[model samples]
Target: MVFSWRKKKPRSFNGDKKKELEIPRHFLCPITLDLMKDPVTLSSGITYDRESIEKWLDDGNFTCPVSNQVLRSFDQIPNHSLRKMIQDWCVENRSYGVERIPTPRIPVSSAEVSEVLFSIMDSTRRLDQCACLDSLHKLKKWGLESERNKRCMVANAAAAGAIAAAFDAFAGESVDKNINVLEEILFVINWMFPLTEQAQLYIGSQASLHCIALFLKSEDLSLKQNAITVLAELLSCNQKYTQALTTIDGINKTLFHFINKPICPSITKPSLTLIYDIVSLSNENTTTEFINMGLIPLLLEIMIDSQKAICEKALALIDQLCETEQGRGFAYDDALAMPVLVKKILRVSELATEYSVSAIWKLSKGDEKALMEALQFGAFQKLLLLIQVGCNDKTKEKATELLKLLNPYRPGLECIDSLDFKNIKRSF
Candidate 1:
């Protein structure tokens, strides 16, 4: 019960096995208390494991984890000296099962990022295909290095301008000629998420957006996934971009591809989210576009087959869409809608259950046909179970109301989902 790995242990069976030795306190990360594999120093003058500190900052904490001092700058430098010392310690204790840490590559610096960005622009301006392609590849590698590099690169105000200018260089080039470079550029731009400031302006224009739309229609799923995700972030940054997205030639239909015939679930989530974002911005007419695109039936299909997380998202979208009269009519028309909604009442997750029940509640608000459908699809029984089992107060209210709405259609037999309904007796 009082075992400790820090204390030295007796030698193992093999004579070559050395006695386990305690790891020096200084060699351990202040945060993790483990030997630092990739030690990095924050501006607050405290060292931490790179992953740990980045996670701390990423979680919205601006203060140093150990010092608890506010960090003015999120920038951190690799504690090369500390890392080397830890590596040596690992080697010195290798016989005790301590493995040597791999040497981390140097973090890309601001100056290097600037120079590479300049190289990309210069190569594009000079029509140096080889040079531009090479620089694009290099920049993507830096983007791939770490999240810190992405923050650094995106922080550069010219990053968006650089990407747009490079894209303009391919104005007349055939798609196949520089497809790789095009993909790389998208990859780099995507890394600069949570687009703060006016960075979105560079590609938010009609021309730039049209180009992105082309990529969205690309037969390549990887390229299309990147384009939709990038568009999703942009829409999140400013709903103004929605106009340019909708105006593009059949671009709205391109988004439909991911949700309609999703080649990858990765693409479907954003597809649903983007639709939600767009509908949230505009009115029910925009929901009409989605309905006309045959989104309702497909949504029901995704909810039935997708995993819980994806199903939750699909359910939320459905609930949002049903807020519109036309959207509600479409859902009511779909045979799967009531059945799927009834099945998801207490199934899936809390959010999914809420969305499913709410959608039904809204659809059946003043319609006798819809209420009959709910009962025909076993919505009465599901709502009964939802009450017998415990749920949040808000959900309980909705379930109770639905049960009341369906009480006239309740079965003649006694309840079977539970032995009693004492918990919800007041509602009855």
Candidate 2:
């Protein structure tokens, strides 16, 4: 009876009941604190979850202890503070031997992979937006890694990405705003240069070269041509890159392998064009290396089998070398110059006759013996046939002009004109 006077000590429910009695203004989920599970998202883009309300009340997030509606959705939650607390807890747990988890491996579908690559290329286009050239440079590396670090995969992806980027950049503008991007792409390609053997095989020789040659077809032809010309110029200046060119096993194989392949009509022209450019560079050592790699035979084969443009380009390159001091030294023992000229004259007989006449004109500029040898090889007959072909009137005039030049001396003059150059037209 006296216990009743003590008020029964309020029948204490232990500290657990006191701890559970607290409430809060806004509740958060125990797992994801900003909102509760199964949130009711509103038209205003707000979310509410019952579990978050319960946790907030249990954790004293609500101010009213007896009122269950103390939580309000309009009231902002302490998301930032809660996030920091959780992060600190994670750090502490990690320190206590809870190993940090790695990102789960994403199983990317092929389509997703393609979309990601497209997005990357799109971002790469905004090269100026990037903080540094290194940012743009890393794109290729990322793409390569996505392709599983396999060289073929990397090269194929890079080639495709580079080509697409170049096309998009050059599509409409003449100023080439994307030149910097293109240069970065080329820089990446140059990094792969040492690995060109794998690339060439992966993309095939023709496709590989075609991709490289895309720079040549840029709308800015000067820029395009300059890219190629600079490399030659560099090889001319720096013996190191030139030596690299000389020792490039891939290029050597590409240049030399074409020789033994049968000269089909379809391939004849391009093969010759490639050879022309390869030989025309200013690098004497590289040129010499090409020559020593048996380029003369290839040139001869092209001269005999190629189209007019191919032949002209090839002959001009040869003419350039034949006029050089180094060229003459190289040609001293090699019958490449004379025999090629003779064979061309005999083959096309009419078309080549003009080239032969021009060749003699060029040879006469320096080596009289070369001129005489050209003439003795029925050069006069070929020249007359050129006039007889009934070609453009300008070509006929050129033939007449060459005839006059060859016979500057009276005896030679009479011998050539005595053949009745004008009447020779009807005989053919």
Give the top-scoring candidate (TM-score).
Answer: 1
Q: Tens digit of lDDT per residue, candidate 2, span 120-167?
A: 456546543233244444545554543333233234544444433433
Model 2 scores a C-alpha lDDT of: 0.45
125-150: candidate 1 lDDT, tens digit per residue: 77677887788777777778777777
What are the lDDT figures for the candidates, one per model?
Answer: 0.76, 0.45
How displaced is residue 257 in candidate 2, in Å?
A: 2.6
* lDDT at position 259, candidate 1: 81
Clashing residue pairs in all predictions, respectively, total 0, 7
Badly placed stretches (over 4 Å) of model 1 are 1-26, 38-97, 118-134, 168-178, 277-293, 323-326, 347-354, 376-404, 407-428
Candidate 1 colliding pairs: none
Model 2 CA deviation exceeding 4 Å by range: 1-162, 166-253, 260-268, 305-313, 329-336, 339-356, 384-405, 408-428
Q: After TM-score superposition, what is the CA distance of residue 348 in candidate 1 from its true location, in Å?
A: 4.1
